[model samples]
Target: MARTPSAMKYHRQSEKRRLDNRARKSTIRTFTKKALAAADSGDVDAAAKYQKVVQGLVDRAAKGSTLHKNTAARRKARLAKRINAAKASQGSA
Candidate 1:
């Protein structure tokens, strides 16, 4: 559909960027899920490890513009809250 040479090049570049962004987004989801599962399992050490990974993923996603900064922040906050709650509940038990 891109008749112009420049337009074709731009299309190719955009597709590549889209693929890269998709990969980053997927990675973020996976990291968040791992962190959540660790928290749910009430394993403090594993939760901590996954939390760090999730934080890094969120930062990378925000930096790359694959995710909005505020969205990333919100997700990170929720994940931390869950981890903390799990930790507290385990301590009480």
Candidate 2:
């Protein structure tokens, strides 16, 4: 199939957006991992900080359509659950 000028332009735009979205998602994953590790290691302060950052990123991603709103909500909820559980254990320990 021959590439039309508009189709070629759209392909380039989509490629750039895909890369941007990938980077955003990667950052979210990295921060979420770090946050979970901190929580598990009983570093509550660090975990809280990381969670805050993750929440902000997730919210932005959702708003920008990089992620679905419900998916973002679920991710945030799960992270909060784990972080809170860690805190609870810390208290009992």
Among all windows of 10 consecutive residues in model 1, the one with the lowest summed lDDT is: 35-44
What candidate 2 gets wrong by more than 4 Å, as runs, is none
What is the C-alpha local distance difference test score of candidate 2? Answer: 0.97
Residues 5-45 of candidate 2: C-alpha lDDT, one tens digit per residue: 99889889888999999999999999999999999999999
Question: Which structure among the candidates has the greatest lDDT?
Answer: 2
Cα deviation of 93 in candidate 2 (Å)? 0.9
Candidate 1 segments exceeding 4 Å error:
none
TM-score, model 1 to reference: 0.94
lDDT of each prediction vs. the true structure?
0.89, 0.97
Q: Tens digit of lDDT per residue, candidate 1, span 6-83?
A: 999999999999999998888878977888888888788898898898899889889877889999999999989999
Residue pairs with colliding backbones in model 1 are none
- Measured with C-alpha atoms, the lDDT of residue 39 in candidate 1 is 82
Write down the TM-score for model 2.
Answer: 0.97
| Alpha-carbon lDDT of model 1 | 0.89
